[model samples]
Target: MRASVSTGQDLGMPAIYLHLLAELLNTIGVDEQDLLLRVGLDPARLQSTNLRVSQPQASEFVTRAIIESGEPGLGILLARELKLPLHGALGTAVMSSRTLGDAMELVTRYLTLRVPHLKVSKRENGSLAWYLVSCGIDLGPLQGFIMDAMLFGCVSMGAQLTGSVVDGLRILRRGPEPAYFQRFRARIPVPVEFGATENALVIPLARLSLPVRFTDDQLAASSRAQCEEALQQLTEDAGFACRVRRVIETSYPFPPKLARVAGTLFVSDRTLKRRLHEEDASFQQLVDRVRLERAADLLRNTAMNLSQIADALGYADAANFTRAFKRWTGTSPSQYRNTWKAAGVGKKTAERVPVAG
Candidate 1:
């Protein structure tokens, strides 16, 4: 695998790490390839650094391994083999930071540099709560393919930093269906609630002062500096595409102009365009992506008409928006909206139309 320095140590894909360890175990006579096979992962992938194992595949592999090995800590053991503490540099850096607010900011800011399909936000409304908001990077709705562990991991990262239990945790699903809430309670002592408006962790802001064991100023500074370097380094990596996507997504409701994004990144428009091209993208591609995402949101969450959606995306007219939408998704705007509506989404219709042209 062409591992970039900007990968931020986490490897992003834990399943790949476990597969590598399984390969190592095979060398030592542990034939865990069968276990990996049982979980639908290719043992050949273990040798390829370029391929990644899916989360569900990894979870099943470990679960089966634990059953066969009669070892309850198999998951933790594989995690250790992956050097998770070091790979979890963002979490470790937050734990080493001087203050809770700074730590939260670091995690929120550099997460995408490490993880995929995650958007984090911190709000201090009387108390501090971090929202692990998911944008549809997985090409599905937030709840469609979200990993169950992510909810726990989000809270666990914060609780580990503070060395204090979380006050509460929330999940923004419309219905309560999972029967494993008790299992979650065993892993996370905090109260967990589903059917909330959004997935978030409600932690007390004052707990930010709680002492952590690994508060190394040098490590914190080094990690923060490395994170910034990694981001700057991404200007030359595949993740440069993600940065362009991010800029475009944030600039939505109105299509972001090239100069504005260039200014935001402190790079010239020409330089930004050149870099994006090198990363196999262009400003127009990102804009189209932003429009598609917004169009999906409007179709699923609002009652916006096609004309209004087109106008919001900076299209001259509804016909143009429909053409662009068809180009991006191979479906007409009205067809897309009707499909989602038939799926029973957007129970509450928006009074105003979305202009995600």
Candidate 2:
């Protein structure tokens, strides 16, 4: 019941990033060593198509490359290298999308398949302003390195489709780069903020309706059915924990305690035990897993204290919450807060545990 998205199955390496990286390096006259240094990629791992790169690594690759290459106007540099129409399978899919909105939906929804570690979100800020937000755990040291390529690619594709420029394009980076602000305009006339809310692409609402060549009930139905089937299979495989996570997400601000959750699912407390038994999970185990995930997000994103967090998570008291937090992570809430505070990372709760359907 949690309104969260997940992959039914993990896809292999993200071809988009790899392709873009190859093109980008070639365009800039940067080789494997340059890329390896930028992305923190091991030389041996670079050759494998199946090797996965974390979002952080992708970010690092782009961020560092700009700094190291002395190509302050890096977005334009990479944009020049991208052939938006040549994205092959991905391009074909977008070309078939019904509306620009629909095309964007498909791309972001399936971005995980292309790059499993990166999560993308789109939000309407005003009548004509929309933000395409991308965030995820960085792949070690390569935080934000590939972002320049990815953002430029998006803009390039937009321009190719409309044969014009986006009303605005910008970036919110992890750290300050004095030259980047000037370079941003040279590449695209959008206002660039160094430490903005998140990495996002701004688009006009009018452009969202621009016609794309791709659309068919048949394709939509098939894709939907395949996605549904895959999700169902994953849920079955993960068993009760999946259901429990779903339940927690859906029940946010009123997350069900064990007894209440069991009651609503049409099972007696005892029956709940038996079912979880068959699934090789206990109610407490499910709860703990959900709580740990939720806690991680909160610690990373919020200033809520131990007591407030504990209370929010349905803990009996601050002490109880601290004990549980220590168990879930190796450190206590205070220590975690102190470390991240020193490191200058913002905190955010992952999301409420997902509730079952």
Candidate 3:
């Protein structure tokens, strides 16, 4: 977990997801009050429109659900409730977009307002589009399950937006297909590939550009404004650390300087320093955090070398990058890359470690 902050405060993933979990458990005969208590969540705090829970708390909540309900596929099962309408203004913004492409673009832009820990990156090349999904931190036992729900939910929304099964849509998973595939078999229109190099949603570009039947400019604008307002409120609600992270994450040249980051947030350097101090975070800490995330992505996803990565991240040279990488993960860049490269071998061994009794 690179996702877990050094800060002691448990500000982690968004809790809007709890709404769906609560709903799903209620339908399956789980007591809502008991569920809340078991997960160490306060019913009152969960009611806030802008509440966030720690990553450990969320993992425990889902783990408890799976154990109590006897549904290991709980994450995928959550797709039934992930409809756009069930979401708030953010959903409305997506629904009102002019086309599926526009809708996805909005999602990429605004999703952090609801779930800060999930990051969606999108790329387009003529008729092919790649939407890659990743978590800010390792999500523990629920990692695969939660990813399933997210990818499947995206496809489900595509159908709702287009009024038909999306054409030429395939999901790429980083690991083997789970045994519970049949639970949502009919829902996916195209073949899903396991052991994929990347976890992505592949769609024919034309399908995304197709006009949405219910596209309304006025509604789109109004809903988008609400989304903006809500996002601003969320930034305010979450506190200075998140705001600081947002600034660093968006800045180019990888790790931005403290003065530049403070400038973007429209606060004086001293004020920014004071605010972060209040939140128990430092500018240098956030720089390392953002740099670590980018470095990890580059190391895992790109063929960039030490010099290339160092230059891209504004480091002086390969030696500087090596030192930073060591500080971040306790390993040099090449070693970390090798570890990820050989991870698949361990995955297979771990999968078959226990023979069925």
Candidate 4:
């Protein structure tokens, strides 16, 4: 199936990842379907490998999974189950790659297609090479789970590609070791060191030339071509408006100015405006949309007062926020929050409620 990326409102984590997670939860005795239902995700939608779950819903589901299962080591466990073929084109490219180095390069470049929030970069010293892993956004409590899945998944993938662990490979993590590590340590193929400078997979430079077990030059070339096309399509489909919305969504000092947002996106102010205009979007409109979404979430879930919510959304004051909010929703902030509460909607139930435009 062909995959298409979307704007910030529709960008999501791959549903397959969540599908695998739910399976793992079920194996561990958690009622996976109920959890998915509570998060407003249909269980059957995950069957399609190309489908994606919206970021908010995915986050909520994952958070609840960890809490319900009480398995902080879920990521590590999930890594073991991620066979090469499950990774789609990137996996095919890696499997057909001529050398270990070639496969690593494909992964570093195309990982965002699978895990949008994580980035991988390669660094080489005199004798040792490191694939440094980092996240694009603040994942908060999910940071460890993501890091574990990524770093450990790399270790598992290496063994799968080469049919054995690469010589002198190890894992380096930034924080102190978690208590759950001892249970899974035997399952990991390589030594793992905690309290390191960064999260990375370390390997000897010479091993980079090791041949992949199933290397096929023609297939590798074709698969690499597919990876290139997929990457291009994903970026193009995001569109200029989507790109601008992404910057606005993640911007610090919430509600950044036009020039700042443009600079962050590596475009001049005029170019940014023209491109967004071509996409039929305005900067202030996009900012207001994001603010309104956040405002709704705060109103529905948090006990924060209007002043606090306004300040969090970068409004000048509560009065200004109330005026803009009324313009957007036809009700004052207090009224909105009160009405939401009066409906007896909690976090889990609120996910199923359709938002009125």
Steric overlap count per candidate: 4, 40, 0, 0
Per-residue alpha-carbon lDDT of candidate 2 for residues 185-242, written as tens digits (9 for 90 to 100): 6645456566665777767787788775446656655665554554354435445444
Determine which window of 10 residues in candidate 3 has minimal summed lDDT: 348-357
Report lDDT (CA) for all predictions: 0.57, 0.56, 0.73, 0.79
Q: Judged by lDDT against the true structure, how good is candidate 2? A: 0.56
lDDT for residue 170 in candidate 1, whole number 0-100 = 48
What is the C-alpha lDDT profile of model 3 across 1-357, one tens digit per residue?
364332323335556677678778899898866876655565544544444665555666788888888888777778767878667777888888899999988888887765555678898878889998877765667676678778878878888888976889998988777777767667667678888978899999888887776788998999999888877876575677776775455444356668866654556899989999999999888887767776876777679999999998889999999998887677788987787778854233222111112
Q: Which structure is stronger by TM-score: 2 or 3?
A: 3
**lDDT for 79 (candidate 4):** 92
Model 1: per-residue lDDT, tens digit, 170-283? 444335645534433455455667776666656667765556656889998888887787656544443555555544543323576788666544468998889899987899
Worst 10 residues of 4 by lDDT: 1-10
Which residue ranges in model 4 land beyond 4 Å of their true spot? 1-11, 239-357
Clashing pairs in 3: none
TM-score of each: 0.46, 0.47, 0.61, 0.65
How far residue 135's Cα lies from its native spot in candidate 1, in Å, is 2.4
lDDT of 4 at 228: 91
lDDT of 4 by residue, 1-357 (tens): 222222232345677888899999999999998887666565755755655555555666778998999988998999988888888888899999989999999989999887776789999999999999887666555567778887888888888888888879999999899998999998787999999988898989999999899898998889888889977877675677766765565444577789876764556999988988998889998998878887887889889999999998898899999998888888888888888878777555444323347
Give the clashing pairs for model 1: 1-49, 309-356, 312-355, 313-357
